[model samples]
Target: MDGFDNLSASEKAEATELQRMIAVEQQKAQFQAQVHSFTDVCWDKCVDTPGSKLDYRTETCLVSCVERFIDTTLSITNRFTQMVQKGTQ
Candidate 1:
């Protein structure tokens, strides 16, 4: 049987809303995983050694690395979108 078939109208609406919320949370978790992966890669690439504290130079480098990664991602995504649109025409 359809799962919602047993639910009242209000319950059905609530269930649908819950499903939407779950999807949104899943997207958020996936985004966080990507960010963590990026940070790990960037950290290894940018930091030469582990320090007891974050010095100004290392902090700047990490920030720059993340920013550049984001910028590159956006640039590539935009170009890909344009290419896809052209191909569809």
Candidate 2:
């Protein structure tokens, strides 16, 4: 904050935007990691063998399981966000 105060308006704006961009990238990386984890878990649950191509049933199971996992994660995230907001208020 002390260093930020010495920055010119343009420099401050640029710095803020850079910080926002970095936050967005970090979020994207976290989401990618979640997706990877979801897929790995679903693959283990749905896949019996590593064939050249997945059969229809296995593919469907993987999709359904991943969707449910993402949905559950979003629901929990939303609940936690609400709780944090309520606490702050």
Best by TM-score: 2
Taken over the whole model, the C-alpha lDDT of each candidate is 0.91, 0.93
**Candidate 2 global CA lDDT score:** 0.93
The TM-score of candidate 2 is 0.87
Error of 2 at 20 (Å): 1.3
lDDT (tens digit, per residue) of candidate 2 on 1-89 = 44789899999999999999999999999989998899789988999998999999999999899999989998999999999999999
Residue-pair clashes per prediction, in order, are: 0, 0
Backbone clash pairs for candidate 2 read: none
* Candidate 2: residue 1 Cα off by (Å): 4.6
For all predictions, the C-alpha RMSD in Å is 3.6, 1.6
Question: How well does candidate 1 score on lDDT at residue 23?
Answer: 100
Please tell me which predicted candidate would have the highest lDDT against the true structure.
2
Give the distance in Å from residue 42's predicted Cα in candidate 2 to where it truly belongs: 0.8
Question: Could you tell me which 10 consecutive residues in candidate 1 have the lowest summed lDDT?
Answer: 37-46
